[model samples]
Target: MTSSLQRAAFAGTYDDESLCGSGLMVVRAEAEAVAALAGRIDAYFAAACKLILACNGRVVVTGMGKSGHIGGKIAATLASTGTPAFFVHPGEASHGDFGMITAQDVVLALSNSGETPEILAILHLIKRLDVPLISMTGNPKSTLARQSQVHIDTSVREEACPLGLAPTSSTTATLAMGDALSVALLEARGFTREDFAFAHPGGSLGRRLLTRIQDIMHTGPEIPSVPETALVRDAVLEMTAKKLGMTAVVDGRYRVLGIFTDGDLRRLFEKAGDIHTTPINEVMTRFCTRVSPELLAAESVRIMEEKRISALLVVDDDNRLIGALNMHDLLRAGVV
Candidate 1:
């Protein structure tokens, strides 16, 4: 940050330290809790991963209270990261949601205390179905852990809550553990960006990765172009009509020969070239940058920014002009 911005940002902090100390302590405790989890990535963690990977069905995550909330987020992360998973509240599981779990699926249950009655109520049914069980709990000797095929200990030294009654450090540690598992499984499955984009196709990130040049490029009459024999004025009229700030100088076969952009026009005018009489081929840039219609829209953005150009011409394998697009097209498509 600039010095002035730094001063403005810290202007009130010198006097508020007393009021902020409590929040600082809470953050520190949670940070320590997350830090301590690095050591717990042991054989038990591997066992859980193996069990989930071997399952042919989705992972069913269940928990009570705060753990349930954590489980829901964990399931979402897992689902988006390549693992097929869903959260089923323990309280709901005992009622009728137990039907969600199947013999082909793996059960990932969360209970900080290792003994949530609702979770315990369905324990017998899980075993009867012969489904593999993975439990994450603070107590290794708890009923949930004792029966689980694999147990992951997510214990924190203490709660961040000063009263030691609220779930804070424990929940943070659980979330970190969930993220660790999610990313590990993501890498193990060889998940690619396209795979991630397929799961998330509603946002800018999805548009950037999934959108292709063909999807947004202007085709047919929308492309700005003029034959090499045309005057600079003709190219200017074409560029203005297409509103792409540039025009392609093509041959009689509609093959791209060069590009005439706003920058080229400015340079030509500096040299006192006549826009109405000068041949476009003489002033246009030769061997202009071209892109494949199948290329990712995000990659096109990278190319445009690197080359410091606003427009790109698309061509076929035979070098025929197929489409055109500019930075504005990308912006409107949300690929920028």
Candidate 2:
């Protein structure tokens, strides 16, 4: 009963079950290839890391075709993770980009087939310059692997492509190997979070690590504060004026004695108390959360979250009020 148009529409269309099975097969094959690499991490890997660490200059990465695309990403990862590296196109190397590579540099080359002509063309130049060469390939006996000081086998049992021609599993294995190398070198170099923050100063992680409490706090007259002797109504006025949801109660020396918030006001209202005539000290919270100016804003966020508070008072070693801040400050500064 199906028309010709309906038959044509279903001819090449895959059922959901077939599509899901095909996708899972590709993922499993690639995962197995990456897992196999764990056993291949030996002394050669250590030597490669040592060579890169000892290099006086950069790590030069080179490859051809699809390998070249993966090489660029690997180079970027290495550079961002404490290793200085860059990608050089094998085709461009013969056209003068080779000058970017120096004897002080270590070359990391990629080629699925060990006989890539563009890469092999530069092997002689690399040797003449006395630069150490590291190769990643599927074929161990290929010319590229034989000429290198270290050979990382990125071989997959079979291509994930149904035709066994397009690169799928092989590229995944190579990229995972690159990540392993970058992370190993990152740890070996003792790279710290601060170093990472410096590299990514504009990112959210950088903001969290580098921003200090003093950098985003409200100081001077912007801080809502009142003398301990002030009335509860006066404290409320200050809080409303500053719109900070709370006010600090301080002694004659400007040392913080307690804090009063809108929540306390609501509790006082339930008791039908004369808040306008009541001393602020009587209703204020005596034990308050305070932080030093040098504390990281990110850590302050954790304190606020743990205590379920929205505002914090910044104080000095002697407990004298220096500044004030609330959740909004952290949010505006992108520290949250």
What's the TM-score of every candidate structure? 0.90, 0.89
Model 1 lDDT, residue 133, Cα? 94
Worst 10 residues of 2 by lDDT: 6-15
Whole-model lDDT, candidate 2? 0.94
Cα lDDT tens digits for candidate 2, 81-144? 8999999999999999999998899999999888999999999999999999998898989999
Clashes of each: 0, 0
Residue 320 accuracy (lDDT) in model 1? 92
* Top candidate by lDDT: 2
**How many clashes show up in model 2?**
0
RMSD of candidates 1 onward, in order: 6.7, 3.5
Which regions of candidate 2 fall more than 4 Å away from where they truly are?
Answer: 1-11
Tens digits of lDDT, candidate 1, 48-106 = 99888888999999999999999999999999999999999888877788998888999
Error of 1 at 69 (Å): 0.6
